[model samples]
Target: MSLKAWAAKHYARRVVQSDARWMAQPHQTQEAVFKKLIRQAKNTAFGKDHDFASIKSPQDFRERVPVRDYEQLRNYVERIVAGEEDVLWPGRPKYFAKTSGTTSGSKFIPITSISMKEQVRASRRALLHYIHESGNTEFVNGKMIFLQGSPVLEKKGGIYYGRLSGISAHYLPAYLQTNRLPSWETNCIEDWETKVDAVVEETIRADMRVIAGIPSWVQMYFERLQSAGSKRVGDLFPNFSLFVYGGVNYEPYRAKFESLIGRSVDSVELFPASEGFFAFQNQQDDPGLLLLLDAGIYYEFIPADQFFDDNPPRLGLEEVVLGKDYALILSTNAGLWGYNIGDTVRFVSKDPYKVVVSGRIKHFISAFGEHVIAKEVEQAIQEGIQAFPARVNEFTVSPQTAPEEGELPYHEWLIEFDQEPEDLKGFAAEMDKSMQEQNSYYKDLIEGKILQPLKITTIQAGGFDAFMKSIGKLGGQNKVKRLANDRSTADPLSAFKTT
Candidate 1:
């Protein structure tokens, strides 16, 4: 066997042995892990302020440390940025992962040495589990390319700041780096258009066996490769077999990606954020990702219907019920205490807990009390696309509440299509019908004439791309919000209208 293949098999065997005990009794494992974290950080400033010494259990921990958003935790993070010791975690954070904010320009999330190690460990476990499950070591034997952000981190206040992907690239083990494609210089190019060209030039001829990135960016790279005289991705890299993706739902882009590659490729989805590496797809047969219970993060769930309530009940791992949508809350070794990361998820399994990301808390559309979410919209679009002879490149939706005096409010859809439908009006009607069937509130609104049918506006081929680039959020983990509560996102998209 090849050296890389042999190493992969050995790693997979070790992961299986290590993971068996935890999977057998996940509840006990999670409880013990949570207690260990509490004891470790009880002396920190945040812990002291919240009376962590008095906390005895999950109930006590919740009562002591109230759930907080980024804005609510800004003060503590700022103190850490000013070089305070033991402000949140034991020592100063190693780096600050910068993500786009709603009101704030950018959010700087702390990353400690312990949290960094956990991130690396969780990622490695995910790959090892995949290898053990599939019995595929050829991927590890060949080159793997991860299309990440610029690795040249920017320093601020004695701490480095960059995209989470960029920060993660810095932590890749030396052994794996030897077989990874795309040189450091190519990865450090800030401009995405330039960076993609450099990546293609450097790795097109390499024996690429695995590729990882956000679906949209990776699709863009595949298109670039196809344009360079390659009929399909497999034509350029015959051994390419695994595709790892996260940051957005892959369903909408699945067909497009498969079409680009000229065949189906095994894929693994991950639920990672700037806050922490949460979960990853562990089994090939199951769609849900296995929750990292023993990772340095303690998890809590609040029902989505009650998330905005004045006193939403928090549920621990033992309290969660399968198939219910809940907004995820975290208390991590990174020093975040009951932090609400705004992502919603649904539990799919109990024994070895598994979950599927439902949507984002802020990305819902409930202006008229329809309570529509990203999942609903995505499903509606998927159904609607079936009646058409085209493919959706990208799309976003918003409520049009500012109708004329006699008219009712309605939903507006802005879409950029790679191929146009033969009958535009039929396609729009199909989408509206699908949505009405899925949401009782929406159906009621239509029956009562409180809202008009959804309006569809087609944009030029590269309209969404142009908008993202205009806002300096064109590439690498950045995605357009699929649904907006207001016209803030949809209004700007109209500027790129094709007709």
Candidate 2:
């Protein structure tokens, strides 16, 4: 091993040890974070309004602060954006992570200094843990790339504002700076298609080892690389060994990625968002990501089934049950209190508090009283691929409430396949069967003839990309929604359907 690699491995050992201590005491660490957050922000406008001074326990917090989505919290956020001091966090946020909003246009999430530091620390520890467990620090010596938004920031109310990924770019550790690929100039290009082309040109010949990004955008980079050299990505960059990703479940895209790279590489999954750096994969063999109990965030969970209730039962770390899905709520040092980030997760293990992102709280279908989520669909697709080998590049599911003459309402699956199954009908049947098995409500609907078995609409190669490009959401933290309750996604995708 090179001197740098040896040093990294040595440092990784200490990081693992430090991480183990907090991981062993999940609830205690969370309580400390909770207390610290409440104490620090007690005097802020939000805290004061919520009577933080009187808060003494988790129950007190739940009673005082109602669970709020971004829409409900916009008034306070707007005040902060107008240069108000001590509005949210103490003083002002270091940056505002600009993200696409639903009812509100362009949401700005505050990234306080304390929160930013935790984000950086959690990401670094994820890598260090990998090195400690696998003892594979050789990748540190080679080129690394994180395909992300441009680093250019726009100033707003005296705070730097940009996408969370862009803000993160300015905070990359110095050690990785030398090894990071795709020159800064290329990264700053505003147009994603143009920027990706530039990235391909710059890193085509480099010894890339670690490539990190959301899977959909990274797939574009991989395709561009393959098209440029007519070689599998694994062959083009033989040293490429680790794939790090977050934002969306990667299982649906796994077959295509493996085919593109021509081999399976080790991967680290992260559960991070503009709201907070929540978790990271700590075990090489485990699918669950280690919940960051010691991070500057306190977590609460509402059982997914009860999330829509007017008064859902909010549970702390000690109250969460394994295997039950929960709508994740956050009370972070970043000044978010009882915040619903709209992600749902299931605790896979509680020994050290490990969770798997189950689906988005809002991303599901219940058109015919059959609630099907992203996880169920993704797993069903994976099951189909296992039963009948096919490579799916991209896919999305939505309820097709209206169909042609004599057709019943059903779920429509628009699939972009890199390699179509020899028996497409059988493949669809397998997926439908798997879905029925996973969700009993869906099974009841299917059996009762309220909904027909899901139908597949083949998308032409590059169809999804074209749709994304048309919508001006082609890259950089943008993800194709896996499940839509309505045809908002399905209709747009229909334009690219195969004849």
Model 1 clashing residue pairs (backbone): none
C-alpha lDDT of residue 20 in model 1: 84
On residues 336-384, what C-alpha lDDT tens digit does candidate 1 reach at each position? 9899999999999986899998888888999999998887888888877
Deviation of model 2 at 163, angstroms: 0.4
Q: Write the per-residue lDDT of candidate 2 for residues 142-226, one digit (tens) a residue.
A: 9999999999999888899999999999989998899987889998998999999999999999999999999988999999999
Show model 2 residue runs off by greater than 4 Å. Answer: none
Least accurate stretch of 10 residues (summed lDDT) in model 1?
A: 383-392
Candidate 2 lDDT trough over 10 residues, lowest sum: 366-375
TM-scores vs. true structure, each candidate: 0.96, 0.99
Give candidate 1 regions above 4 Å deviation. 387-389, 403-407
Estimate the overall C-alpha local distance difference test score of candidate 2: 0.92
Model 2 per-residue lDDT at 239: 95
lDDT for 138 (candidate 2):
93
The top-ranked prediction according to TM-score is 2
